[model samples]
Target: MDLNTAADAHALTPLLNCLLREVAEPAAEHGEGTHRLRGSGRLLRVRGGRRPARPELRRADGWHPLSHSELVELTSGELRRYTGVSNDELPVDMADSRATVAALLAARAQAAPPRDPYLLSEQSLVMGHPHHPAPKARGGAPAASWLPYAPEAYARFPLVFLALREDQVAEEGGPSAATAIDSLADALDGPRPPAGYRLLPAHPWQLELVGARRAVREAFADGRLLRLGGSRLPAWPTASIRTLYVPDPAADLFVKFSLDVRITNDVRRLWRHDLLTLRRTDAAAEEGFAALRRTGSDAAWLADRGYRTAGFAFEELAVLVRDGLHAHVLPGATPLLAAALAEGEPGSPLARTADPAGWWRRYLRQVVPPVLELFARHGVVLEAHLQNTLVAFDASGMPVQALFRDAEGVKLLRDLDRPAAWQRLVYCLVVNHLMEIGGALAERHPDVSPFVWPAVREEFLRYDAARGLPETAELLAASSLPAKANLLLRWTRADGAAARYLPLPNPLRD
Candidate 1:
């Protein structure tokens, strides 16, 4: 909370430093704006012109304003008021759960599911599509078949956390449902409860493919989903786990569940290993455009422009209760942009500001010239970031769409032989999404100074010198250690790159 004793950053630094010197200080000098504080004295007084306008019924449209009690009064309110416990404290009965079947056989003895990862009977999951549908001139009438998409009708149930308890489930039920649950623990678990038990609507993709894979265990020193939702829902505080917006009985979707198991099922198994690295980098850019079929090559010049791809199974994100017109546990679109950046107005210019030059101009117009026109017309490699990208925008704010999920993170070249699909697309887009969330946003936004890390390694060496990729300065000097560890691990990780909605500048632009 120290932006030198923040009082809304000294009441919005005098009209936010004259609106950041009228949008980026051109040699400063905007007077009339005021601020004054002197010496060991308490002269502290500041103004941003009477402010007050925020509450648009505490906003929440499109989401990304994180504020969990103003991030527990900015980071350490008694370590965010300790409220833990609840791996759904089993033994409600299933042959007495056996520690959820010995923690799912010690996480299927350290991972092994790949091979035919998920093409789900060869291509067909481009929800609400239209990639191209006019080709009839080949002798007339023969297009329009790629539109029907359905993952149980526009999927849902990704997360919905909550589960807490300590001691008293009548002194921890042990001996066969503890004597009929201590004489009907209030008609079988449901009244005057507190010193222990809560468990609300779980299902971060069934705790990552079943009650705890703590979203891919990844040890740090002997691990099997221990503590912090012990493989998926603990770390108390009245047993938190809030995110729950279920609704998608068939479509017009919505399902924003995540009482945080690293935002449910570990970011949905890191977006299913980046859609298996964009399906073997879209099948090695369709066998390098079928080896230049008649020398015209076009997997959309290598692939990335508004990239779109999807195929998720895990029993089509289960967990249902009821809600007429199709409600597969709805609510998402990042909790409506984290509830409109948590009721906007921290100097609100429609509060969704994100920088680093509109994330390198939409990763250089919808992902670096479509992976530099798929490595100069066919030798592919489209990784694209932010959980293998999604973005999607319209109503006028531009950026139309750009799905691109994982297929491990898609790479191809080495003369296209496909060395095990370019080592699982360079360990899931350079070691799990840009060096682990760009080293947690460079250890929590050290004042946003990652200077767009060498301007995205000089925009991938000017996109391999204007699209003639391959060995492009040895893959831009081996992609700067996962882009300097995701620009220093997404600035200390708890989803903060100023809470990720990104893309800015239009504060009424200039």
Candidate 2:
């Protein structure tokens, strides 16, 4: 396939998968080229199942292949007919998502990838959130506007520095002596702050988008905030687009900034309430990781150290500092994004492994135990979905560590019902994270597929004796696993935090 066709196919796969899994069912297959959509009684066909699905619609004359735009139109019409709910914006977003993927593909061709394996893995998620309909959509913004900051394009740029007046500064939590936010200032190549002002960094792209807001304008006008140019060191955007990684040898750190665009279901902003409880959540995660380490698991949680922002633009301008991989990673080991591992990016250890079964076992040993221990022993439910987890591999390309991040998504048992928290954990850790990796491995080594789930069950059994989790028996015996309904959630326009799940067949069940 040509580059444009290849890009369209990658973009169309997730959209079609979301529509099929969430809204439609299969009625019949005619040979390998045609099937019927159960909801609309419309005949359709695709090249693959779940992902990389190339859709075609049956017509009067013959089977008509649908382009990405045509597939969006078909999906919109089917959803309207199936649910009688008309959505105008989703179609536009769908088109925007396809266009964005095309732009990313084009840009990646011209740009050079980061030499660092970690950064390359971070930027490798060109086809993001494999199950979400509009994962790449940037709130319908022009591709030119966001491409400079797009991770998939391997784009890296300097941060915009700001000087905030003392009284206007708002912050929460405290940083460890080693990973303090103040240390970041030493690397800035921007104008010096005025004598009484404190240094704060803002994402340059975000500043361009929100600089015109009344609060930001007033702050600048009244000298509450001063623009001090950009940083000297370039920051690499990770898979999570809003977060950037600075590769400073002396003070390496990951800085997360608030972007006002809707990525997937939610607007990517640092909400005030999340910031208020940041310390509690982060402390819980740190404690949870420590407990796991005592159990001899090489799992770590990247601490979300303090944030700094103006009181008026708390969410929009807020910047969060996180621990860099250099300090936390195992000796002689390289960390890679778990999602990229599943998706089979260049330099992925999974792709290069000589022994798939042994590698899979090592991966399970590193990943599963820590998550289960944290949930049962510590009451900390990590959002251990593929995107949030990082798998570090030793020199031999065997899995050596599993590191989890993102304090915002953590749920404590004290805050949520234990049963509910366990369910969410199962969904995030198993259904969303492990299943994808297992599927990728199976695709690579179909001969060893039979051993996959049996091994997972054995791993669970190893933990069952000590923790005795209430859901243990049910998890092993359940007919279905909870799968998040991303398509329906977006269709119903529900709050992003309000997750609703549908039951999918549990693969681990005997």
Candidate 3:
């Protein structure tokens, strides 16, 4: 497919997915790939597997094909009719997202894909978040402004070193892990600051965005902050644009920065609220994974160990140091992003896998048990969605381990009761993560597609039978699952953290 066609299709999948999921009537029989719009009384048709594309709308004249732009307009109009709200901002974001895809494709053609499967998987989400409208939107910034730092374009850039006055540096976490931050600074080949200052690495793009601000400039002028140039080597931007995975063993850590620009649902920033609660959340998740490991499962959690930032521009200048995969993943296993797997990235190393059944079973074994255990035993409801989850495969191309990250997204039992926590876990684990990956697996091995959901049911059944968990019993009896209403949330211009959920069909059988 050409750029426009490819971009349009890439952009339309989520929009159509939203429309079909939220706005369209469920009782309307979807013949093949066609469905009737709920409120507008319009007929729509599509024919594609996984990421649906080539959308057509029916009118008195005949079938009218909708491009990405038309899809955006239709989605906007449908959402307006459905929600009775006019969201002018989302359409522009949708357009920007398609344009961003074109820019990424163009840049990727000239660039070399990473040799590491993990890096490639990290950058493979060209059509990210199949349920999110405008998932690839880059805050409506100019393509030139964001393209060089985009993960999809294989972006790698050195971190801009900002030396904050020792007295002005704000941070929290245990000493052992926090010392790694200082070690990373001492290790990097950047200009040394005067004796009293500490090194604070900043995402170059974030620096560009927040540099012109009055507070940041004032801090630089006074002596609270000093610009000491960038690091000698570049770091690979991960799926979450704010996070970068440093390749070197000395500084082998995932660093997350506060980005001012909006991506997907929120301004991709390490907010102060999450930062304040980081240690507690990280500790809880760490305990959960540790207990799982004691059970002989190699499941791990990449704890967000510590963070450092200037007190003046805390939100904009903050950075967190997360545990790297090198320590967590099993020997001879390659950690691949779950989102990329679900995306059906063609170049994935899994091409050699012939036994889809065994692979799928092993995958479920590694992923499902730990997540359920975390919820049931530790009361830590992990945000184990595709992006936050990684499946490490062995030399034989079978899943050997599962590793999860992002302490900032974790919800503690103190905040949520058992029922609420269980509901969220079911959605994140079953609907958002497994269903997509399972769909990709089914698409690849249609011969075993019938076995997919049945296996999932079996896993839950086995889990319940082994643990005698009431939550699993309730889930098995439940008729529907909660899916995050991304399209509707965007249409209503709601906060990203203020996620709204709607009922979705459950495939589980008693």
Candidate 4:
């Protein structure tokens, strides 16, 4: 397909999905693939499946097909009317999302995908967040600004190195009590800094955005900071555009840098509040995964060890160090992003399995157990959604293990009430994660699809029986699942950190 056509198809599914789920009601009288906007009481039609497509509006004369831009207009109009609110920015964001996909398609045509299956999986999400209104929007910036660093484009580049004077450094897990961030200068193999200076790696895109600030410029103008060129080797941008995977054999690690631009919900900057609580959150997650290890589960947690940033531009220049896959992944097994699997990535173990039932059983056993176990045992609520997870496949394409990351999204039991935590867990694990994966699996193997939900129920039943947890019983008894209202949230222009949920039919009960 041509880039525009492809981009339209890519962008339309998620927007249509949001509109159908959040803004529209079933127009059962009109027929299947038809829905009426609850806000406007107008009918719309879409060919539905795992990816809804080819949306049309029921006009006075007949059905009129809607183009991508027209669909964005309809969504903007519906949201504006529904909420009794006006949003000028969201419409631009929605349009920018489609434009961004077109740019990514153009770039991917010329870019070579990485040789590694893991890297390929990470870069495969051209259409991310199935329910997000504008998943691909890069803070509404022009495509040229973000295209070079896009994971979708298979982009990789050297880290821009800078020397921070020792006195000007503000670090948490480094210095007196050191983590990887302390000695990262030497490990990165960047040019040596002066006797009183420490090396800091930065995202080039971020530097460009923040370089003009008086504080940043003053540091460079004086002697507090010095530029030391880029790193010798390039790092691959992962599915999360800001976090990168450094492929160095000797000093392999994932480095997350602050990007001022917003991607999905929040600006990708590593805010100071999250930075302050990083160690605490990482420790809790580590403990939860360690408990899984004691029970003979090989699931791993990629630790977010430490971070480094200059005091002048704290959030702007902050860089976080995360654990590499070397120590965690099983031998002879390749780890693939869970999100890519949900997208029905071709030639993957999830796609290649002859016995879909068996593969799904293995996948559920590896994925479902840890999330429930951690919440029940450790009071640790992991954001166990598809993007935050990785599943490793052994030879013959059998799933052997699952590993999870993102300490910044972790929530401790002490902070929130049990009910709220449980709700978040269900939303992330059941609705967002399992539902998408099951749909993908079903799409590929329709015959055995009947057993997928049964398998999930059986696994949860087994866990509930073993642990004697009440939440499992409540979940099974509940008629609906909490689906995050991404469309509604975007329409309201609410804080991304705060999520609102709408009820979705609980597939577990099916």
Candidate 5:
């Protein structure tokens, strides 16, 4: 495929898969070249599976081709017909997503990827959230507004710093938060905060978007908030664009900011409720990881250490400090984003591996055990999706450890019914995380694909035998896995936090 064709294909795959999986069903396949979209009874042809699949619709003349724009038009028409409800905004968002991918492709052509495997892995998600309809949409913002901060474009910039008056500072996880922020301040070269004000860091893009708000402006005028300046050191934006990685030796921490832009399903804001209950969730995760460690598991939890923000502009101004790689990673092991492993990046161990089966086995060993142990033993449901988990590989490029992050996504058993929690766990861990990685590996080595699911089944069985959990039998026997219905969720304009799932065929079943 040529460059533009390739980029369009990369952009269209997720959109088509989402439409097919959520709103339409697959009808009789026409050998290898064509299939049918069930709702409209329109025959279609596609070249891929659930991700980045190229699609075409059949017409009276012959097999008609669909570009990204044409695909959006088709999807909109099909959804309107299927639901009897039209979403004008969704079609716009879908178009915007395609445009954003085009922009990223253009920028990537001119930019040099980071040399560090970790940074490369973090920034390599050109096509993100494979099942989401509009993964790269930037809330309809202009490309210039977000390109400088985009991870896919390999963009990195310094954070803007602010000084919030002492009384206006609202924070939780006090000691840890203060220390982490203070460390960041020490490393940054910026204007000193005035006498009564404490240092508060702001995302430059966020400041540009929300600094003119009445509350923020009033604080600046009333000596409540002061613009200190930007930091000297640049932070690398991770796959989760709102979170940034600072490679400073003095203050090594991932700083997550509240970006007002809509990314995927939600506004990328660090919401007040999540911040208020963060410590509780984090404490539970820490306890859960501790218990898992006792089982001699090498899995680790990348704690969300703390957060700092102004009381006046809490969610908008909030910043979360998460544990950095240097502290948590195993010695002599290079850590990489699990999502990047599936997506493919420069210097990926998966792509370079000579022993696909052995590598896949090591990956399963590190990723599966901890998630199961934490769920069964501590009732801590980790959102162990590919983006939330990192795998550290030893010198031979075999996965040595699995590290999970993001406390905001964690749910304790007390908060949810066992069945619901188990479903969420199965969806996030098995469907979202394992399935993607396994598919990627399979593509690289189709011969080993058949063995992959059996190995995963075996791993779960062994864990079940040791733990004696009845849920294990159910999981192994289940005909379908819970797959999050992102397309439907967005179509109905439902709250992003409210996840709805549909049954997808369970590959783990015998």
Candidate 6:
């Protein structure tokens, strides 16, 4: 796990130099031999043993070497297919009389030229439906349909689409805006997944929405759905009112609509100022929004610098354009399953045990700092909860990226009557994010008793001292900012030792 050191240099240099070359960063330095790697792109740190002979430790291009378990799980098949070799050809190392798989992948001294040398046009395949015919001219001016009421469960804005079975004519009742949504709930008698077409299974969160009939109908009638002619209907199935379309076997682009209603309601209120801050297309304008999360600010910064909004919003709807930040969506992408980690489900990557703390440690090391940076720049706070945050992995199974969504939950501090910026930050950053995982960790390891909610709060304060101590003092002095957040930091670090805990459930054992 100790990746920083000269001993790892031999294995690191090959990949590191190649990564540097790829990025064209001639001035990149290897800090103190083992200091943490730093960069802005997806290719983070690339270090692995060269040809399994001379071990190399390097950091370049966000692509880090996959862990042994990850490598075995992700690349074994690809290695077999690419090398045209059976399991026997793969190397096995006998360490302490235990057989271990160790393949000597040739170290490409020069970072392999972008793997496939095909034109961008030749390389990309048309995603979703390859062919979508125009709607046949048969009906009168399309009748308008509007959802009579909105559903309470629409907190997470969902990008929806309208679909009709192949047999359903353009002028049929199902095609009308009103009934188009109803079609999703109804089965397609004639429509079937085409040949070679695979159905991507919907996750539990997605399934929950699909199962609700009223929610789907409201979403459809509200014009939140993407319209597709006959052939396009198969790819974007919103015909049924009872089911939310899980755009699987579909493209990565997800659209969620945020109408004026979401902002107007007193409950789960979204302020207009927040809307104004979010609406500002200029990344330079981020300095004013005190509630924006560090990651959100970075996004605005990137967008300001001519970086395409791999994601953006049009009115209440937000679209994720499957580019840039969203380039890599992994299996354990959403932290939803991780939310249930205390309950046994080894399949989930977030299930941290005493032995495999690497994933969470790396996750925290990479994510938290950037998050704080974003918060410092934009007062906007991103609710990077289990669901809103997504983990993107590289070619290997290791997590190398993070995707954050749910713009509605993203809060603006000053917009509130009395902005408790720090309180909000602590509630979200510590109470929400760390406490959930910490509770799970404490459950697994009872010996680590000091790692309670208060202890975690102190640890956060310690981290703040080390990273943001100057800013912390300045914020305390700034009367404009909320004092609760500042006080929480002080009380937790100075007087939190005697803090009594209310009876709490055992997060893990239960």
Q: Residue by residue across 1-510, what tens digits does model 4's lDDT show? A: 888899999999999889999999887789888899987899999996879999999999999999999999998888888999988888788888999999999999998999999999999999999998899998777778888899999899888888999998977765422445544455455467889987788888988889999999999999898998877788889999999998677667898998888788888899999999999999898998987898899999998887888888899889888989999999999999999999878998978899899999999999999988888888899999999999999998989999999999999888999999999999999899999999999998898788989999999999888886788878887899998999888779899999999999887774
lDDT of 5 by residue, 1-510 (tens): 666776687778888778777776655556564556645878877776546365778888987778999988887787777777879898899989888988999999999998888999898898888898898899888999999999999989998888899999888886877888877777567667878888898888889889899999899899898878878888989999999999888888899999998899999899999998999999999998888778788799989978889988999899999988888888999999999988866458888789999998899989988888888888899999999999999999999999999999999999999999999999999999999999988887788988889989988998888886678889989999999999888988889989999899999899
lDDT of 2 at 371: 84
> What is the lDDT for 505 in model 5?
91
lDDT by residue (1-510, candidate 2, tens digit) is 777897788788888778767776565556663556655777888875446476778888988888888988888887787777888888888888888888999999999999989999999998899888888999888888999999999999998888999898888765462236667677778667788887888888899889999999999999999888777889999998999998888678888989999999999999999988888999998998887777677799999987888889889889998888887899999999999987778557887788989999999989988888888888889999998999999999999999999998898889998878988999999999988898888877787789889888877887787667667788999999998888778877889999989888898898
Worst 10 residues of 5 by lDDT: 26-35
Assess candidate 3 and give its lDDT.
0.86
Candidate 6 residue-wise lDDT at 499 = 24
Report the lDDT tens digits of candidate 1 across residue range 322-355.
Answer: 1111211112211112111112213211223354
Give the better candidate number (4 or 5) by lDDT: 4
TM-score for each of the candidates: 0.22, 0.97, 0.97, 0.98, 0.97, 0.37
- What lDDT tens digits, residue by residue, belong to model 6 across residues 209-320? 2324554445446533323322233222111111122233323232222222101111121223443444332232334322334323222121211111101122222111
Candidate 3, 73-93: lDDT as tens digits: 888888888888898899999
Q: Sort every candidate by lDDT, greatest first.
A: 4, 5, 3, 2, 6, 1
The alpha-carbon deviation from the true structure for residue 46 of candidate 1, after best TM-score superposition, in angstroms, is 14
After superposing candidate 2, which stretches have Cα over 4 Å from the reference?
28-35, 175-179
**CA lDDT scores, all candidates in order:** 0.28, 0.85, 0.86, 0.89, 0.87, 0.30
Worst 10 residues of 2 by lDDT: 173-182
When 3 and 4 are scored with lDDT, the better candidate is: 4
Q: RMSD of each candidate?
A: 24.4, 1.7, 1.4, 1.5, 1.4, 22.6
